[model samples]
Target: MNEKLMFRRWLDLASQNILTRYFEGEGEGSFAELPVRVRMISRFRWFMLAVFSFYGLAAYGAYQHSGVGFFLSSRQSLVLFGCMLLVVLYNTFYNFFPDKYIHNRRLMKVQAFFDLLFVTVLVHFTGGDVSWAWPLYLMVTFEAAILFDKRRSVIGFGFFASVLFGFLLLSEYIGVLHFIEVPFFEDHSHHTPLFSFLFWIWVCMLNGVLSIAATFLMNSLRHENREVRTSRESLSKFLESANDLIFSFTPEGDILYANSSWHNSLKYDLKESHQVKILQIIEDSARAKCMSNFKRVLEGDPFRVMEGRLVARDGSLIDIEGHLTLSTGPDNSVVLWAICRDITERKNAERQLFHLAHHDQLTGLPNRMFFVERLKQAQALAKRQEHKYAVIFIDLDRFKIINDTLGHAVGDSLLKETASRISAVVREIDTVGRLGGDEFIVLVSHLHDEEDARLVARKLLKAFTEPMKIDGNEIFMTLSL
Candidate 1:
């Protein structure tokens, strides 16, 4: 069993070695530079040499009656071995040279022509039509299919093999060449015409069919390869033409690639792109968060959607939102990839909506809801830090009466003037708001004492004591505190 296993292993290795060039040596290039066909041809020659040596040695041993029943007679084997040796010596010149003539179909056809003739010789010595060696003719045709670029060349070689095989069989049947049948098998040295005809048909059909099949297979593979290359190019073009900022970075924050949108927005050219880093474009307020998220993803966390402001070329910040993908690059290095959309316009729209929700539509002061939230925030601060703060409330006396008699235009004008006066009286850290119907509130922070609040209230009342000119109508508005 061990010997059987070892023999099987040897056969596998030998077959792989012989076919290595056919399967792996053919590379992408012009036909003239396709070096694999050269290697394949050399490998085929070497394999044939090994077969000849093995069979010749066996035939020599059988000449002494000590070998297995698998070899031709001693005289026949000697002649065949000598001829094959000359062929090998002739092939040696080709092996030592570069494969510059592989593209030359005439030279390739010549090689196939000689190879078929030698295979015919192998069949002649080993038993002519009845010899298993006849199958080598088909293998030669297959080799031609691989080496020749055109299907017509392969078919031509196959046709040539059929002619050589037919001549050998017919000559032996008619006694032109002495028929040598297999010694181990039943001898058919004087085979009938019908048997010779049938065997010749089988050999020719196999060679022809194998030739067509091999070429078809090669063409299909080439078509598939072209399709794959085209698809890859299409995807590359799509990435370059996309509107969103697509980018990739290394673990050290070095920029690997940035699409056209990213480059144009950052105002970095192709030449300067290599010098730009990911952190350089990150808004300072968002840098720490961005780095933290990057570290988390590097440590095996899933991809994260990062929101940060990117500094543009004109010193303006763009709100960018994207998901970061962590992948292992070549040699297993960490790569951070992102496809971020510039959300600056979207963020600006959201801010406007927020302002409309929280501020007065007319005067742009904080509305009732916003003022209450700030009051609570101030209340929490005062409690936490013992901070002094106060809230002052004021209402315009008989403001509705002015709206009913002099019209709402004058009433709106007076309200607008009052909001500005109150805002002007408060500190920058303070909050001013309107509660509608000529009512307003102020949040005063960092106060010294209760007396400070009274002083601010008095300052506001004295400022409003002067009449406000609204729509060219002077109206004295008294505040009810």
Candidate 2:
């Protein structure tokens, strides 16, 4: 390829989105607007095309009338039209090119350069040293403040505008270039060469100052507005890394966000949680307590710690102990946050320990310690109501002989059968317990007389009359009370 072809290929491959970058904010921590920014820049391109087309038509009309009202000669009008077409050509070229991040910022700078160059031409043709179009320079400077580094905006746009405008005015004043005079505006060409130099210096210094001021002011406002975005980002990252279940919910019970630990422990899909209400995840038995706490949080009475049961996605209950707090969101909406540890295994272990301590493991019957407590309660109730109560201590006869011959397992089956038989004959309010090996006890209360106690004892003795079927062996046992 030749040098001209290589240069043309380079220009065709270039693409930029300065307007998009400015709207999205220029650098780090600037996401969440990428998709919206893309569409905005697409519309801005059409707007720029409309502006170029409008000016092109104006120049074309002037050319047809030989500088009639627009004060454009044949050559100047063609030059303007041709210059617009150059920008249009590049703009059209970029439309067909795909945009992606190669991390090159030069594309924006190059586009800005072209814009400044084109505007310089317009400033000179419309009015020179006394140009009414100087505000156009500040407009581009404002854009530079947002989309480019502050230091670079000062040099690239501010100093560069001064150089272009100064060169144009100085050239025209020195008679090196023809100064086109607009019809109504005073001819600045007749002004002294020193006046042009002094005007350039004034413009140059002012650009530097205004560019710096605009950059700082814009940066301050952008940082202030970014507080919400930064807070959300920090919360997501910090909460997600926690081992405890962490979550946030709206005041209306809608779950807003849940960390990975929360979703995993609950067996819930994070993506589907938007439709799941906060109280819906709590176990049915615990919903009332959770709702009470939820209301408390809304009322600014959040708890320091609480115990709750959460219903998992698979309909299993999970015991959790945690703390909940009320918080204000970026939109000033009230929200609740929680950090909970899974206490399911620990709670299960506690229940198991209680069962073992107060019940007979082999017979699955209340043991000596529990039976004694019930005896004390029954004594107190009988005294209060002036009723008689009786305690029967029954021992199985020949229990040791059965265990030695038929084995301990068979012996255990006999004891369990005995407990069940006794329980069936007694009133529901009565207590039956296995005190120890081959030893059982019963509590009979609300008796009318000595005759009532005798009747219950007779019923107990008859319960052992039937043979017990244990481990496919039949055995007869008698009880002594």
Candidate 3:
């Protein structure tokens, strides 16, 4: 299964609940609002269209009106119109064209060149030395910051500024554009051509200063945005790979988030439901206890833990140990983040160990220690019932003689057969225990008289007398009662 898709579904549900609470009691505000795909697409389209439209309108108005001597001539106006048309077409049809065509690196380079060419034409159309087109260099710097790496963007901006400066210096030297003359004295006659050169130098310095400042600010903002995106990506990756079942819940015990491990262990389809309460998914007995622990954590406790059973989808029980911690949000409300581990195997191992400790491994009957404990309880009950009881201790007669003649292996086989024969003669209410080698104990309770116990013991003795054949040898044995 795709784990990332599962996690995102959980987060979407959690965000819904959070938004509901945040807007609670405010009429018509209870509904959660998630940005839809269509809204995102529309916003992007509108933003790009607005930016290009605004620049196009401004250039067209400048060409038509010569206010402040910033108007372009016929050739410059035609170039500006062509550049604006290209921008409009690119933004409008980029989504329609295949991504390979729209995002071609060669095409981008061509667009950038045309953009610079239009700016240069506008500079020349106006008075080259004194035109306000110098401020339009901000657009070039902005494009560089958006479209290229920091070093490349800086280089692009520097190159555009150099070319524009060179054109301005050439125009001033060739007398194509009248240079501004600064009066060294209050008399016009004392003014020299050196004054005009100094004035142009000041204009150049101002243009350089403004362009660099705007570029630095734009680049800084872009860098900050990149860092934020990187941090978010790293956090998302860490959450997806985490082993523990991490979750958050409401104060009322509604589930907010459940990690992949939780769904896999419980075999539940968490994605199918939007809001699941803890009690709905957990076992009945554990529900109250789990909710209590959740409350304690939500009441500002840093850490609280509880162990209980979680019901799986197939109605089987799973042992779980849960840890909870309270986290305070920006709004001063409490949120419970919990981590749980499946302990089914550990619990099963513990039960198996307990069973092994009390029962005999060979015969699957009670061992000596357990028999003694049961005997004490039985003796107390027998006293209350006012019944006669007898403890029959049995030993296999000449058992070692048989072992020495045949082998201990044969002796062990005979002992096992003897125990089974004795057990068959005793009542179900009676207790049987193997004390040690060749010795066994039987506690017969609820007997009417001593004769009842004697009959059982005699039967056990007779049963052993029926010779047992081991390793092709016929052996006879007796039971001591």
Say which candidate scores most in lDDT. Answer: 1
Report the candidate with higher TM-score, 1 versus 3: 1
Candidate 2: deviation at residue 30, Å? Answer: 3.0
Encode model 2's per-residue lDDT on 1-481: one tens digit a residue: 6999988877664433443354333453443232333333434555756975786587668756774466768888678667677777765644444153113456656666776777787777766877676766766665555546446654568788888888898788878888787665554444787877888888777777878887787566656657867897897788988889888898778998898988888888967788899888888888888888888878888467888999888888889999889889855988888889999999999989988999999888789999999999999999999999998998999999999999988988888889888898899888889889999999999998989988998998898888998888989999999
Q: Could you list the CA RMSD of all candidates, in the order they appear? A: 9.8, 11.1, 12.2
Per-residue lDDT of candidate 1, residues 298-375 (tens digit): 887875578999987678888989888888874698888888999999999999999999999978999999999999
Better of 1 and 2 by lDDT: 1
lDDT minimum window of 10 residues, candidate 3? 29-38
Candidate 2, position 100, lDDT: 34
Cα lDDT of model 1 overall?
0.81
TM-scores for every predicted model? 0.54, 0.72, 0.50
Give lDDT tens digits, candidate 3, residues 320-432.
88788877665676677777788889999998887688767655567788889989988898899998889988887898888898898898777777778778888888888
lDDT of each: 0.81, 0.77, 0.65
Would you list the rank order by TM-score, best first?
Answer: 2, 1, 3
| Top candidate when judged by TM-score against the true structure | 2
Over the full model, what C-alpha lDDT does candidate 3 score relative to the true structure? 0.65
TM-score of 3: 0.50
Clashing residue pairs in candidate 1 (N, C-alpha, C atoms within 3 angstroms): none
Model 2 worst lDDT run, 10 consecutive residues: 31-40
